[model samples]
Target: MIRFENVGVRYADTAAPALAGIELTVPEGELCLLAGPSGVGKSTLLNAVSGLVPHFTGGRLTGRVTVAGRDTRTHRPRELADVVGTVGQDPAAHFVTDVVEDELAYGMESLGIAPDVMRRRVEETLDLLGLAELRERPIATLSGGQRQRVAIGSVLTAHPRVLVLDEPTSALDPGAAEEVLAVLQRLVHDLGTTVLLAEHRLERVVQYADLVVLLPAPGAAAVVGGPAEVMAVSPVRPPVVDLARLAGWSPPPLSVRDARRRAGPLRERLAGCSPAPPRQVADAEPVAVVRRLAVRRGRVEALRGVDLTVRPGEAIALMGRNGAGKSTLLGCLTGLHAPTGGSVQVGGAVPHRTAPRELVRRVGLVPQEPRDLLYADTVAGECAAADTDAGAAPGSCRALVGELLSGVPDATHPRDLSEGQRLTLALAVVLTARPPLLLLDEPTRGLDYAAKARLTAHLRSLADAGHAIVLATHDVELAAELADRVVILADGEVVADGPTAEVVVSSPAFAPQVAKVLQPQEWLTVGQVAAALDGGR
Candidate 1:
């Protein structure tokens, strides 16, 4: 249905091609996945298919591109609207309506479809994407994942043959991501719609991908194949694949379940791979304490009277499904949102009562969205700004910023940098202040495996250095691997809090594959699982 012939694209103001000599095709109804590290032209390729590359983006395009038998250069976005629906990473950036139902109907209405057809399509989309219950909810009231689904529903209602999504599940929680993926699966199986999606979280979506297109890092080539062929041969792969490879398992497992089922002599190979248990440092003094804290957003009570405590050197993961008030609790902790009742004390000081500058020294918070913290002309400048404050020494700030950029890419614009890089930079800035407590919101949202490893290492280092770390995330793997304790919140109140292994690895809401396989064992990390398998052997 779509084909790229020797496609090479270069954005203006740069010498390198974003996409280089790409030759590929997608048959009708094929759920193709474009995978690679960031800035390797996954988005560029998707944009090419939707006529957004040379048309809206104003970039140089070479070679021929055709979608549904029409030349992409000749077919404008409006002309190809009926054939293709594209959803970018930031759903908020593309929102055209404030209500859920209205947003779903906007695209069909714009195409001049009849009212009956539009309404029918909208209802079907809402039902398929499981948005019928939220059809009348305000877009503002919906959770991040719900809004993302609404974004896809709006595009899907157009009844386009091809759906191209750029990191559609990046902002969604695990359960919500499953909902979106389930809808996509239905669309492919029931409606025969083609899907070409670009996403960084390969672990969640990799197994379902029928065709995988692996792009090389900038200035390299692209690789494409079916699931087993691509995953086995590609340079980039999920952790399970890496484990399978390292353990000498033939027909490598794509998921942990398959690995367990196929376990043989390979189990012995993984026996000695366990990481050291995360230390549980004792700090009698709690740095931050929340007691009966209540937070209200508009008419909704986002957080009820909630209590949480963080002691120096303790790492606690605050987890919940989307809209369960994890972010609201973080907001209250960081003073971004004032509590409606009760109190929140940070580093033994009341958050709302302390000055913002004083809060900076006592507590560091990396917000859910990294873009809010980045606005400098260069990556270095953003780092510099993050390191320095009103009273911090300029020399000290510059030195810290330089250290932060040690592994970051050269000449890369912070805005143009990948999600993981931006996240790393944000954390580096937060760490520059050397606060006693660090608050990280959805810290692993867009990170790939390597970046996630680095992040885990950094967090471990921070905890080892006696810093209190509070992370609000849906990443069960990170929580399992890094956190010493887990605190689960539901409807703004703490529902569970205990050892990370008990609260996260064993909890129904966030159990890792290893935990599921060895349910009674309570293994959370790959290392732990490896040790168990080895000990069994």
Candidate 2:
């Protein structure tokens, strides 16, 4: 059980408390979802539970916070290791070992558990998280989603009574995300583990939450209640909730199955009218061409004989399961990873042979780890450096940052910003040059709904302005809204590639929530259905 009474946290430089008067109680054996917008105190609250807020983060904490009746104020994270297992947003930062098996066992070794018990737990965790095949792989060689699972398994092996996860499924593909969520469900029901997690992808986890804790904004009072009660008034909502609202369904549905059961009449109403089709980008001039591309890392083949063509004014969504060569393909485009065979030409020049300085003006890449692109001490310094590197106007990068994510202080350290904020800053850095070709790997990993909408609009504008965009992502709803074409890859090869609606609507794994609910219909988003209804009326 976790309890917070009149809890408030304030950093040294900031005047307003990051969180204040957050009175809540999470019962034992229940999975409680901590929901809020970006820059909110969701992470701050989780830190308070694990005794990291005032201890590791160097912040002032007010009032009492207890976990399993143990006051976090008295016990440090190491002291509470057996009772609390905390997994932060960045998994690589938490890893101490190179191999998957060693990282999973490191936490238990630190706690001095019996070797037999540790081995048993390690095997169980590997099977539970679908990481049996990757147990021997190096940590650096694994994909982003694989790292996330390993980070969670390392904590789960400790068998802590309370588990605190920050964005546990953010990096996972649809299938892998379900597996992780299923593991959490089993822990809550069978093992009596208390789960307190914060996630931006509400569609994946909201249906499983036993209790919902809603933080409307920074420094505001927190709301706690049943899932439906909180979601009706919550600022952030999933596609299913939005669809219910558009269809005028009372007591908005919380899951796809629920929404589908109530969608018969609405489906009939829109039967004759088709949603407006996406703009045609395939006819535009080629911006990049790949002919039989292949990449080898060590012995593993990351990409295999991939033939593709990207054109100006096109928005391509590169999608597949974790470790499916999506990031590797993106790297091939930006010259980060040279193809072992075949040819890749961007703007009439080979990416691997192009000069680095000249490549900046021809192509840009926003990698999965946003921090990798940032090196400056402060936000303003990073913007200035981007301008200098890209040969852009003095204020161009800063202006893009302001437009994409507002209210961030220029003097704040890039390290101190939230995960979503860091990603936005890195995106601004890449966009400064206005490259003809843009590639982003998991661009909306930590963004909330509002932030995702802003990014979607900005990327759409770029595509319309004759920029070719290829983004590797697992966010299906975003693909439905922004991508003109969908390209699915599997095991280092393209499995399917076609127009967005044709590809996503036909596939079960990649279909958006609205598409699932209104099956036998071609609608892919709530906006599409809303437009159809208004036009019909």
CA lDDT of each prediction against the hidden true structure:
0.79, 0.93
All models, RMSD in angstroms: 2.9, 1.0
Model 2 reaches what TM-score against the true structure?
0.99
Estimate candidate 1's alpha-carbon lDDT, on a 0 to 1 scale.
0.79
Error of 1 at 322 (Å): 0.8
Global fold similarity of model 1 (TM-score): 0.92
What is the TM-score of each predicted model, taking all chains together?
0.92, 0.99
lDDT of 1 by residue, 1-537 (tens): 889999999977677788888989888878898887655778788999999989987789999999899999999888899999999876777789999999998988888999999888888888777788888889988776777889988998988999999988877777778888988888888888999998777777888888999985764677888866778876667667766665677667776678777654554444444545667679669989998988888877889878888898999988887788988888788788888998999877888778997888888898867888777877667655764562455545445434443345435677776666677677766777778889998887666666677678877888888999999888887888888888888777888988887676556658865565444455566676556556657
lDDT, candidate 2, residue 258?
A: 92
Q: Model 2, range 292-378, lDDT digits (tens) per residue?
A: 999999878999989899999999999999999999998888888899999999998888888988787889999999999999999
lDDT of 2 at 423: 96
Over 4 Å off in model 1, which ranges?
264-276, 390-413, 529-537
